[model samples]
Every structure is written in C-alpha cells, then in structure tokens.
Target: MNNRDEPANAVPRRAVLAGLAVLAGAAACSGGPVGPRRLRIASSAGDLGAGLADLVNRHLRDVEASVVTPMASAGTVDLIARGEAEIGLSQTDLLGVDASVTALARVYDDLLHLVVPADHPITTVDDLRGRRVSVGETGSGTAVTAGRLLAAAGLTAGAYVRSERSLDNATAALTRGDLDAFFFSGGLPVARIRELSARTRIRIVDLSGWAGALRSTYSDVYVVRNVPTSTYQAPPSATIADATLLLASASLPDALAYDVTRLLLERRDVLAVAHPALEALDVRSAAATMPAPLHPGAARYYRSVKP
Candidate 1:
C-alpha cells in the first residue's frame, strides 16, 4: 500500500555506465586480477541501500565486486563489527570509536528533514508543541537522531505527541492528514520526498541553528549541511547532517582495502548516477574520517592520491 501513487524519476543508468568506463584505466593500473572478486557491503534497506547496491554492481563489474547484502545502516555496521561483512555504509553519528571497525572513507551526508503540511504553522523544530509527529520507527537510526535533535531544539520527550512509524507509513499518513509532521534522515532527493512534493504541498522545517551545539556536544558525527534550493524546487534550507562512512572490519587485508578505497574514489561520478547525493564525496577529504582508525591500505591509497 505504501507504493501507491508514488512518483519520481528512476536513477539514470546511461550516465552511470558512462562514468564507470572512466575507471577502467585506474583499475588496470592497480594490477587488477584477471577475474572480478566478490565484494560485499552493507547498507540500510531503503533508497540508500538499493541505490548503492546498484552503483556497486554496475561500476565494479570490471573489478568483479557487488553488494550482496541489504540491511539497515546500523545493522550494516554491526555486521562489520561481528566479522560477517567486510564493508558497510553507516551514519557517522551511529559509529563508536571502539567498534572493531576501520574507516575506509566518508562517502556522503545524510540531512535531517522535518516535513509538515505546507500550510502548517510550524516553522522550526521548537514549534511542534502538542503536535502529532512521527520521529521515525522506534529504535531506528532516524528515531535516535530525532531524539538528539528535539533535545537540542529545547523540545523534550513529552513536549509533543510522538509516534513510531516507517518512513513510508509516515509519508502515507502525512498525505492523508492523519499526522501533523514526520522526520526523515537520508541523502537528498529522497524518492518519497520528491513524490510527496509533486503530489502535495509540504514544508521542510529548518534545523540549522542547532548544528553548532550538536557538533560541539557530539563531535564525532554532526555537521551543518544545506539542502539545495533545487533539490525540492524551493528555497535552500539549512539542517544538521551526519557523514555517511564506508567501514571495514579491522582484519580486512590492506591490499583489498586499498583497492576498495581506490575504486570508490575513482568512480564517484558513477555513484552520482545512482544517487546524486554521492557527488559530495571529495578526493581532498577522502581521508577525513575519524574515531575509527583508517585501514592501512586505505591510508596508503589516500596518500598516493593526495596532492
């Protein structure tokens, strides 16, 4: 039922394939094996996971790697910690320094979106008093982040009518006017956001003022990010964000780590085809991850490419 009347553009495959061709030269330079090796990565089960899985399958076809698992971003990191997965994509805010995981690179940013009916009186997080809002599914990453954000915005647990629902259910409820607002934490151009935008009038509340406090209090994971005006055909909105990282088991071989990092850095353009949000990955900041130590192979690759 959640898929009913959804509207959005599918990811463009032609652009991604063209970008994938650009990496052949780089892969060859690494003395890639005669055959492709299976590569596994964990991503949450939603647009992020599906888009990433598609990007990896297409771009790494030559290298013979693909994402074989689809799970929540938090679960992805957990699997990495448990040694069941070699790599995983997760929100930086959710990661801890002690997790038996190594940073391969920071891939993209996930912005917090508080959406309400376009005509709703709420203009900021503090205005939700007595309003029914779905912070996100109980125990989900979105819910965890929503709690921190609400606290930072001076709204405590009981300040508003809080509910638990999946993003899809929340979107449906919003469309039906059953709820006052909902929260989504993900990269830009989320399909549901776009679909809702096109079908109904909605507003993305501003949450930028709390960024400094969030960063200061939770240094390892928070950042200030502006959602572009073009993303939803409206004025740009400022919000707090958390970097998304590619993590690996500390025991992963350095050579493989190097290859994975290089492959990602080299084919970022292709990734953009899967999700334009990934265009944010920068070579200059490829090594700018922390808490978790960088895998030696990733460290070597970053040094080689840094100007």
Candidate 2:
C-alpha cells in the first residue's frame, strides 16, 4: 500500500523498474567499457610520431591515443607544454629545460642535411652568402639548428635571402629551381630526399667542420655524423646530428607514464618493423635525456628493468 504522505507526482514502482531496465539494455548493447582515457601525441606528419601513436592505440586497452601532426619538432614541444598533447616527438636541441615537459625516451638521432642542386657552385656554409635558402619552416627544430650552424659559420641573417618551407615544399621548390638550398634534419635516409635525389641530381653540403663551433655553444647536443654516399648517391659527407626525444606532459599519472614507457621498450622489436629508426632505442641511452629529466613514472620503469 502507498503511504498517504507520498507525493501525487511520484512515479509508480513498476514504471521506475521499467525505466531502469531500458537504461541497462542500452548500456549492454554499447559493447565496450565507458569513458576510456584519451591521449593526443603531437609530431610531424608521416614521421615517427604517427607510428608511435599507432603502437599505443594497438596495445593500450584503457587508453585511446591519437596523433596530432604539427610538422615541426618545436611545434610538438609547444603542444605538449600547452597541455594540448599528452605526448610528443621532438629533437633534443628544441627541448630546453622546461618543468612542464618530461622525457620518456631518447628515440633516435636526426642527421642534418644541407641539400643543393648538383650543378650549384655553393660548397661551404660561407658560400651560402647572397643565395636563396630555406632555413626550414618557422618554429621548426630544423630552423633552429640551421640558424645556429649558419651563425657559427659567420653568416648572419642578412648574409642570405631565407625562405621558410617544410621538407616537402623545400624539395619541390629546389627541384623547380626556385630555391638554391634548404636545411632538413631527419632520420637516416629521409624518403622525400631520396625521391628528390632520384629525379634531380643533388648534393649534401659538408657541415662536419662546423660541428665543433656548434658544440662549443650548445654543448654536446650537437655531434658529427656521416650520411653514406650511397644513400643519396651524393658525395660522402658528415653533417651535424642531434637526438630525437619522446616527451610527455609532466602532469601525466605515474601509472600511465610507467605503462607507456614499458610498452615502448618491451615492444621495441615490433615497432622497429614499421620504423627502422626505433631499432636504435636502448634503455641506457634512452634514460640519458639531458636538459629534460625523465618523468618519474618513466624512471620507475627503467629501474624495474635494470639488469
């Protein structure tokens, strides 16, 4: 029997049970857990950033990860620092000491390439004076390194007419004879550059001589590395190399960071299948993210796996 004090507008008991049953049925038909955590990783389009994001989505059941391609390492770092992306792939030199960002791993090294037409007379950095050059897109790690290298060689901004373009755009412009030279920093044997070489004869200028100048100003973050002559069918030359780092927001949960770091290393073999550069990942070297400390969660994973 209903109490006399019951409100006249109160729903009947049977009706309430029917409504609950319908809600339960809808949930059952949904077929997956509700409210999975979402993560966005920022990286250059068609680069390691996209590949790593694919890895995370395939393995992590509770987290949904996606890649946001800003097409520049400096752009990636900016995204992570602004809390727009949970993870990012960036060049080590682009990552200054920032408390908001933490490293997950040192993935690989990006070799600097100074591309010019085979017929062009320019040989040394000094020869770039009064020439058409692209220092890389604005806010790119390539631009930062290129500017520093040029300055080290005593070429000021006024020394050359500089245009900012992405790797693809610069390659196209160079092929059309619109640009004399452009700087690009990428993993060994960049596919775009290789394709450009096949269609148009090109040369990679030697920058090894200026490595010492760069190291003197930026410390050991810059190093000398050789690009095999066979890769681009260009003359054998050495160029500056810098580490590429995987970074994350410092505020990420310790458990999630640990899980992410663990997946990255344990599945290195599998990831390497898609991104050959990932084969260079080593725990010892990865933990040495200088200038940017490892996230505590990442550090925990390293300690657990120490031999």
Which is the leading candidate under lDDT? 2
Tens-place lDDT per residue, model 1, 1-307, is: 2233443554456656877887877788887756655556776656444554455566554444445454445576778777677787877788875557988997777888998888899898878999999998765668878888888778886899989888899999999989999998888877778788888887788888888888777664777788776787655788888877788888877887887788788877876775777777787666877756788999999999888
Task: Quote each prediction's TM-score.
Answer: 0.79, 0.84
- Model 2 clash count equals 0
Off by over 4 Å in 1: 1-38, 47-71
Model 2 — TM-score against the truth? 0.84
- lDDT for each residue of candidate 2 in 209-239, tens digit (9 for 90 to 100): 9888898897678989998889899988899
Position 145, candidate 2: lDDT: 94
* Model 2 pairs whose backbones collide: none
